[model samples]
Target: MEHRQSFWENLVVVAIALVLIQTFLDDFAVVAGWAWAPREVLLYAGLALDVFFSVEFLTRLYFSFIRRRTGIYFWHERGWIDLLASLPLVLLSSGPAALALWSGSTIALGRASLLNVLKVVKAIRIARVLRLLRLLKVFARIRNTDSTMAQRHVAKVATLSVTVLIATVMLLGIAFSVFDVPSLETAYQSRITTLLAAVEGDLDRGAPIDAGELAARESSLLAVQREGRTLFSRFDSDYYARQVGPNDYGFAERGDFRLFFDLRPVNRDQSRNNLIYFAIIVVTIGALLFAYSPHFALTVTDPLHVMTRGITEANYSLEVKVPRLYRDDEVFELARAYNEHYLPMKDRRSAASADGFDLSMDDVQGLLDD
Candidate 1:
């Protein structure tokens, strides 16, 4: 049971880390038009990870209840953060896509307000950063080792870096969306114009016009209408009605023939600039993180960890070995104090115990030698 628990706990840590990385890559997929991991892959992966986190939250809740530590779990252990990061995120991230698929149509620019609302909601996926805070819970579970504090501080620094990266990605995504929407709309209008011209030519020649054939050839057609009547519809009656609403469909009129086209196909191709921006952001953020990690550990966490271990140990004589490259900074002063002032005072107190009480191994050995 203990080993199984250990395994799952470790798995939770890994999942937390993976999801954070995946969420960042997802921004690249969605906003930057990164083909390496497409939007579909990231969406499904995010859903799967969200499920895993939900299960983890429930399991932790159950165990905490059984142990009669519900308050500790929810409040102190940040079970709320787990729940916050899990279910709401799934709905926010995947909900719009699911709705789009169900309706068999993309929300048109006519519903720009609703589209903007969805964009803001989608931006809430940044809450996935909350998962980083849960890493602190894992740190609390870790055994008291010399490296544990160092590991925790490193995790904190990493979490902060990732949070900043995510924020930058969100801002960039918003900027890209502005340009991308117009580009997609232009593409849709161009396709509709070309098809309208072809249909007009066919009408002039009195060629048999088959909306089904045209739609089949055109992957983006949700439905097609002639003379403002439902000539051919790919949607069910209800969805078709929804598509014909004033703002939902685009129309082109020539003499006696009126043609209406569903504009949802515009989403199939992203703007070229989106792809360029995606590459630049991903490479730059990745390079920055790679360069930052070692320097952060060496200068900050390593020294703090050494001081922590020295201070916590039972031995009064333990000395902090300041690294050769270490500056005469706060950590250096801490080490100097530990080795000189603190250790000497502690040793004097220990030596004053003439009855040889509470003597450590070094003290006993020294006494034996004398």
Candidate 2:
């Protein structure tokens, strides 16, 4: 049995190492929040990996509880260690970086309170490993090919999951679509300002913005103003009573920051709608679609996003790489006019071929005949 003990010890070591490494990723917060040198995308990537380890730890704990029930189980030293080891992984789950992207403070607080019982996705790559190990270990113990308490527990969890998910989505939809936004003294600034500057550089290098730049900026700024109240006003209840707000939260009735800055919003309605619906629908439909695949045909929305781009853009050969997708002579005139007259657009817009615009193979012969 020393060999059996050896395997679990080794597995625990791996889990412990992963969880410890995951906890340190909050160190990247300094980079993500930087004004000029921010690496938000990479920071988020690290957070995602941390989330994976957190989920793995929780799943193991859930199975452990099911395995230990007898009075002796309570007094078992190894069992005690097995149950308590999951605690460190749990505490690391809520480091600052993970909470930054959380739904408003209200929802975030609620989720934090409930994390003690939470489980991660059952089919993620890590979960598959746990399942495989269990299968191999239990193969000799199968009882006449029927009911186990673990299977029952899984069913109960599934039913509860569906109910909770639907309710959560409903609340977020209302919050996102209908609730009025208040102004916020933001805890974290956005990286969008940096992104917009980069986009402007692309535009300036490509075409004169005197007329065009003013236009895009004007539209984008207006979006910011209109949505400012709706965007920044999230709050915590405890914070409402105190001067700065409690535990860095507030759920104020109204608030905005457009008053303090030379601000503009980008397609505010569309951005908000996408932020709310796209996130929810993509997650909800994705989960439901995968879950129901055993019972029905399902197509995920993100995979179908191609048909959603503008038809004008669809025809603009300059916009996409598909040689046959667009025959836009007009947009070619537009791209060339925009490019040759300017510093020349960099990246995809600059590298796009003018020949592809209207010069089909047939058009070359027609021009020769002419």
**Compared with the true structure, what per-residue lDDT tens digits does model 2 show for residues 39-104?**
334334445544554454455555556776433443322233233323332333233424544532
Residue 219 displacement in candidate 1 (angstroms) = 15
Write candidate 1's Cα lDDT for 1-370 as tens digits. 9999889978987887777566556554444433322555666677778778888888889999999999998875557767766776666645454455447654442222434543453354334334344444443454333454454554455445544554565566566556555545445555655676687788889897888887776655655656567666666876554323332344445545555555333322322333344344445444434554455556666666666765565453456766677757677777788777887776776678643244567868977888
Model 2 CA deviation exceeding 4 Å by range: 1-8, 27-73, 76-78, 85-370
* Candidate 1 Cα lDDT to native: 0.57
lDDT of 1 at 227: 59
Question: RMSD for each model, in Å, please?
Answer: 9.4, 29.8
TM-score of 2: 0.22
lDDT of each: 0.57, 0.32
TM-score of each: 0.49, 0.22
